[model samples]
Target: MEKSHLESALPIANERNKASSRHVRQKLAWALIPLTLTYLTFSKHSPHMSAFHRPAINYTAQCIQPSALFPKDTPELSKAFDFISTPTFVNASIERLSGAVKIKTETFDDLGEIGVDQRWDVFYAFHEYLEKTFPLVHEKLKVEKVNTHGLLYTWQGSDATLKPTTLMAHQDTVPVPAETIPAWDYPPWSGFYDGKYIWGRGSSDCKNQLIATLETVSLLLSANFSPRRTILLAYGFDEETFGYHGAGNLSALIHSRYGDDGLAVIVDEGASFEEAWGTVFAKPGAAEKGSTNVEITIRSPGGHSSIPRDHTSIGILSELIYLIESTQYPTRLYDENPYFTQLQCGAAYSPEFDPKLKTLLDRRLHSGSDETSTCMAKHDPLALEAAKKGPEIKYLLQTSQAVDIISGGAKVNALPERAQAIVNHRINVGETAQVVFDHLTRVAAHVATKHNLTLHAFDGIEEPSSLILTHNEVLDPAPVTPSSPHPQTPFSILAGTNRAIYGSEIITTPGIMTGNTDTRFFWDLTKHIFRFAPGYDDSEGKEGMGNIHTVNERVSVVNHVNAVKWFMLFLRNLDEADL
Candidate 1:
């Protein structure tokens, strides 16, 4: 108490010092207020703003300086650009049909023999439409009918020395289940054009490719643009029905006439450069993954509902699910993967991560944590992070499969003794169907034995072929070409369109493909095959894109025009290359 009183009496000078200290702190906070506001504004606005719009534009300008970015022009590059820009007769002919023929889906009664009669009607209608609409082109093109399913059009090239190039597309489309979709804005078969798109089933799928090839041929005929190589357009009618009678027979015919080595390049449809990925890299499919359709079944003795066995068929099926989830395929790098390295280069183009990326490219650093942390700091972080995580990330980057379909149970009260499940696997590149099946068998056996259950396997052992990229050296005979095989050019993956009929090859690229196409039949013919489409990247679910094989399917008018342009550029670029 005495000390407190003494301090209170002597605190006038101390009180003044304390007041000065508080005033200084307030002034310091006022000074920092503007800085804090500036930082908050910048953090919020930077991402949405383009580099050109930033307050500190000099940073972006300096980072993307002309010297550091792609060069303006060189003799070779100029040549390439000139070739890409040149107007071909093919381009002009497509412009003519750009407004003419209307392709629509053909409908049929859902009653008796719907499948057979509808397929026949669709085929005949297609043939009739070709005859009526493309009479002139049809007259010039040699058409060969194969059984009830396949059609081939041959346009002899001007250059007898060069091997022929075959452009392939399927005529048939997958049948729509009548119950799934109730109605369409334009009836599926109407082939309606709303001044901006072609509304129908096959517009983007194979019909687009079919029309483009025919248009190219028509233009060449009109302009007398004789190619040094031959051109053949092959259309398969039964492509939707596994291509057994369409592409299968045509491939056999090709093998008989040309042998394996005589044929130059057979282009079909598969992958396309989507805008989503193109934001990072211009290249689309350098390789596609393999696929296998598998069916698994478990059966037991049926019994009454009241007195059931300890382990019913449903119980056994439940164990199978656990087995599949627990086992996963081993992941590795694709040896023939030109796309991956090209993607890495594209990722390094931005200013912020260039130094760190260069270190990764040089293989001086192998730290995932450092790479991942650096990527998350960028504006476009997903793509960079995916690249840094390496092959495992890429393998699962797209929707690769563990399971798709599962079926079981018959009645409410019955102890069902039989259960089955069908799993469709879109295999990672470099992996085979047999390997996947072996893994499944092992896992299933382990689970079954552990539960004292009997497991019977029936399907899913068939192995589809791996992906392949055509080297310019191998594809020299083809007119369209790429500049180099430096893991960046589009032609690094120009295998024949039909990979399913051909089997796997040394030139193949390892990856996974999420969807199925007619190119599956070509795997029997040659392993040096790949599947891809051009014009637009429809990989990501984007607007202006149609629901493939569903009601109200359509393709944009702009996409159709660009399709013509891309095909022309691809042809000219390849034709001019020395290989």
Candidate 2:
């Protein structure tokens, strides 16, 4: 393929060199304070908590705790729970499983006959099942088919004036390589429930969310619980492969319907229960870091091995790599980046942490880590070790980036004239791809005086998005200040959802997401967008988490029941509010 316009527009080498040198000097000067703080923080270590007072607590009780934070219980909640828990609903779910099996069987049958793409066949089969089983929903909802890969369903709200809420889930599953785990206790696609868990491929990555939303809406419809705001369900089929068919088409469709007035909230599959300090935080996701794929290329005159040039392409590329390794991005402990603060706070609350350190952990940001001992005493021990190494290490602790690909040499006897490397970056909050690219460009140019190197960004900027709700909007401007005490300004944090798509209208929070999902697409759409799933933590530790997107992917009988109840509560609370 020809070089893109971006690749061809590499700036003059001298300019980058000068800029890089200035940046390096500035970074070196500013490094002293953090370096001192790091030293002090690492010097001391506190004793561990007693075994009897271990911080870890049961997950279910934590979730069911009576808290003023959530919506007040409605009479409908118990009814909803009862219906979901009943044998009739369980049987209905079982029948739905059988239906899914038949659909998959038909899909395989058709694949054998027509030789269609397996992914397309699976999507078609799921689509057919939805239409047949939820005929009433199809009739009432505004449904549209996206070409080849996805479907959209919109339920117009009772109040025509209200904005819409979108629920997203992907229909696709990552292909389980045939050679990898050959035998399952039950067939992978059979959707068999063994009294405790359901076994299937797409079970947790999405089908669980899909079933929960559908069943929730179905029960609400049966009870005539009409929403005041429009609701949209977007089901995509190719999320595993860049979400081209699913979220891409759905995003276009949404843009066409709402324009810049934008969506109210986009709910997607991510952010749920996780063991934190031995307790379940049930962290909800609010925003995600942006991603950029960059390419760095080096070129020079070719030569025979017997007469190599003073600076060959590979040698030049090596120097560029060294510059990147040495240079580091800044780590600002800004309050807007709340994930770290929350983690620190949660750790402080844990019984596992020493009581003497609790006060430091609670106000660690304000104290500003006067010394390495104090900083280490307040934060995670692992994080402290990483911070001392420099900005590159610290940056990865918060965001994502990888030098994933590289290529150079051609023949053994001849020196290659060109070489290249690709760096994939996940932009942290309050950072832009352009900034990262500029930093790289300057660094590469500075090192290229002895070689010939060119740097270019392969992908455009994907800026992070956030939502921050306010009550009177007259409070102090401190970034770490808690949200207003208004129902509209719920005390929630953002994590793994695409709420950034809507821009400034919505107030956002920074949520830490440990895994990647299809929710990234919504960052361009709405402000109040959040990634939340209602399921109690299973007691099996890491194995429980592994079940998701794995062989025994399942939502427990109890969790499936609670999911319906929780969804109803969320909908009711959302509907009653102006937000």
Candidate 3:
């Protein structure tokens, strides 16, 4: 009996040993899988690594790499950060800027066609203050008044072989709407400072950049630091009013002086990013969407209310609006669509991002930075859902249309003789204004034919613009800012400087700006235009959302100080650079 029991125990113990060995092997395999993939990842990035030798390597895929995207930082970087963040330096800088904001330099876009020159005395006073405040800048730089209010300061650098750079800031600011006046924590026009905050209009939108620029240049002059490459301080009087006279005239002046392709790079105000998802990203605006306003009209003979036709002019206008809302611009995402690449980059690099989304994006990286395909399964559902929930996402993906104004009926119970609307369109990449116009006209014609009414795209306020067919941009999308692509492009100069000043805390990506800026004037002047306003506001819910063009509009004091430091450093860095 003892011998039989021992044989049975031996078989049981043998089975247990086999099971433990299998479990160990399984765990080891799972651990080795990640190690193998990581090795393959590094191997593919290596110059000498071959796909044949390492079959698992991602040989053709471009990744959302962190270190390689930006230039290596110099040892002086430590001292640079120290100089900007000091309390004494920052405090003094903010106090002076707060005083500058106290001057109300509001610009009003009037009557749809003409700019209302309200508060001329205030503008003149602001101009005088700039001269008084920045005496060093006024005395050293060759300052000229373009259109009286616009300040054109030229700091002629030592070398002409190096292409010049233009740093732009607008003198004018959008008027505070009457409806939002009550929302102001401080008076909209009162540029008040109560210890920490600088209160008022123009404090954030652009005045922060404008004032900071003057300070930067003035201090540089005080230090006797002259640039090696020519620097232009282009300030626009009517940037808030579309910059026709302000930036437009400045562009003409620049062209006459330096010929076509005059500027090496132009940095204007538009957008910024400090953090996104679980990661941080620093970006100056790369490209912006195009814009156009189409004035649509339907006309009919006046008829009595009692004896009205099947549909009135006003009814038809509403119908048209419905049609536009229903039939949105086609949702097309191509390889060249600028926003997609940035979207992909965000999903792939951000640690907090959904893993499934990252996997999808990584699959497309095989096309080497170009989005290989617009994954139908992922995008179709998201796009449809976003259309109902978030218009902002739709706006980024495709051309967007907004039916702004509709006016028709005059007296109560009277049949309307005419009805009109202004449909504003933000033209998308891979589409044109003409194409959009044609689409609208075609739809209008079809609708009119069905209703038996006369439809026309008028050129009047209530009419269509005078230069619709003749001019390419009839309130068309703003010119997309040009990019001098990476490694050693004109944009790399700004990128390098940004990385140096801001550091590698954020993964920077190029993206399309939603709105227009003064940089529109410099389209032909330079192939490289970056809409970058360097100010970080931890208080403002998000970057670029800082109450700009809104009541209670204000920027952080530290940001203003940083702007001054950034420009001073950027100019120095650019001077030292080969470009």
Candidate 4:
């Protein structure tokens, strides 16, 4: 592949790792704060506990008590678990995943017009690989090809009354830089299994997930386990490039068939469990941040560099960028925010949680909105600490803006007629694209007035020396999935299934995905969407998860095996679940 091929791919691993690392650091910092205060007094009978801490106000009792559940231990379930646990089965699974990782189904941001782009031809080979490997799946399930490459598999159920369960994963991997190929312990696409990890690019990212879901279905087929509820498996081919051609098309078909909130529940690859504050914590994404791209173009009449005006288009663009960056969004902690619930869970369950921080959190949990708002506005110790942590910390509570792309003059001797920048914002919960539009409009209006330039915002008015603002790929924050303590709800069942596999001591809490997923396109299919992949998080003691989206990316055999087992159990539980 040309160097340009790698360059045009959407940025993934580095950005994801940076944001993930910062979030982890912020969590640790929250637990490390040193200050002691008396716990805020609250009536034991207080019924005003946030919905997140439903069924009780005392955090300790509710979150610590595990709600682990399992499907009735049938002979089929026992055989499936026993078979997956065996060394022979594990080695086979390793090979299964290794085979998938070896395939290069890389997707790029600029792989323009799918059918016209020969680059997309790789997915055809990937399709053959899937069909060839999972014969049982191919033979038993009804498969439909959406948008040529997207895969939708349906296993018909005996009953039509129950809603279908949808499982998702992406088929594409980000391009491996040609320059970084030599740094790998094993070749990036080798899928080399070193007794522990299957080393490759897609091993850790999504091939592990894709393979696990398919393998589980195949295993269940072998066990002759028929479900009362239908199961739908959808795999998008271009999730790395915003999934427009892949999941975007698949979701439209799903919506048309199922209608609004039609599916029983949708589970996709997302946040994994990590060790923190002396316990294993699984943070299945209950919500995800929205996203948008704002284009700011400053158009002017070009002139000789020697005869530059008071401000060229490039100069004005720079000033606008500065103003946009300087105007930061305030981080407001709401009682209903998923991260807030995560903190509450940590305080209640994490054995090593800092008592001082716990006390503060406890106080905030019971305090009135007026008091909390005042503290946040004043940048009190709590708010100050959060800000000091990093942008990822603030991002958990507020929208994030970054000036990612910028371009200007093509020649040194000539003033540029057009200068442009694209500002990317991951919209926070409780905010919309309009809020971003309004903020940018304010800044652009001020700059246009100061420079005495014509302004054209959102509507194109081709004119010289004018400032224009337009947006694309706008998405509002996903509706928050209910994480009620009621055991039968989708969140609880998923959480319970997590505990059943990982152990009762494991803490499962509702958390938000700071990054978006294919679930963004499937929001209409079901409100009960969960972005969780049952794998061990790459924390201090856990090294199973390799670097995702970069060289040496790999997934541990143990992680892959557990994912397969978990999927089998989760599906069985869903089949039997009344909800």
Candidate 2: global Cα-lDDT? 0.56
TM-score of each: 0.65, 0.68, 0.79, 0.86
Candidate 4, run of 10 with poorest lDDT: 36-45
Q: Against the unseen true structure, what C-alpha lDDT does each candidate score?
A: 0.51, 0.56, 0.68, 0.83
Compared with the true structure, what per-residue lDDT tens digits does model 4 show for residues 1-579?
Answer: 676676665466578888999999988877765421211123312323332453335776546444777887778768988899898898889878998999999988889777899999998988998999999999999999999999999999998888999999999999999999999999999999887789998997899999999999999998889999999999999899999988999999988887897899999989888676787788888899889999999998897999889889999999999999999766766555687777778778888876555655655655545243554355433444444556756788888899999999999989999999999998877667888988999999999999988989888665787999988778888999888856577777788888888788788888788788999998888889989888663432556546887788988887888888889889998899888
Candidate 1 structure quality by residue, lDDT tens digits, 368-439: 232223434432233344446554455533224456667777887787766666665655544456666666
Query: Which parts of model 1 have CA positions greater than 4 angstroms off?
Result: 1-118, 179-185, 276-284, 326-332, 348-399, 455-512, 523-530, 536-541, 572-579
Global CA lDDT computed for model 4: 0.83
Comparing 1 and 3 by TM-score, which wins? 3
Which residue pairs in model 3 clash with each other? 280-506, 290-477, 291-476, 291-477, 458-463, 458-464, 459-463, 459-464, 460-463, 460-464
List model 2 lDDT by residue over 233-256, tens digit each.
888766766665568778887888
Worst-scoring 10-residue span by lDDT in model 3: 463-472
By TM-score, is 2 or 4 better? 4
Task: Please give the ranking of all candidate structures by TM-score, highest first, separated by commas.
Answer: 4, 3, 2, 1
* Order of candidate numbers by lDDT, starting with the best: 4, 3, 2, 1
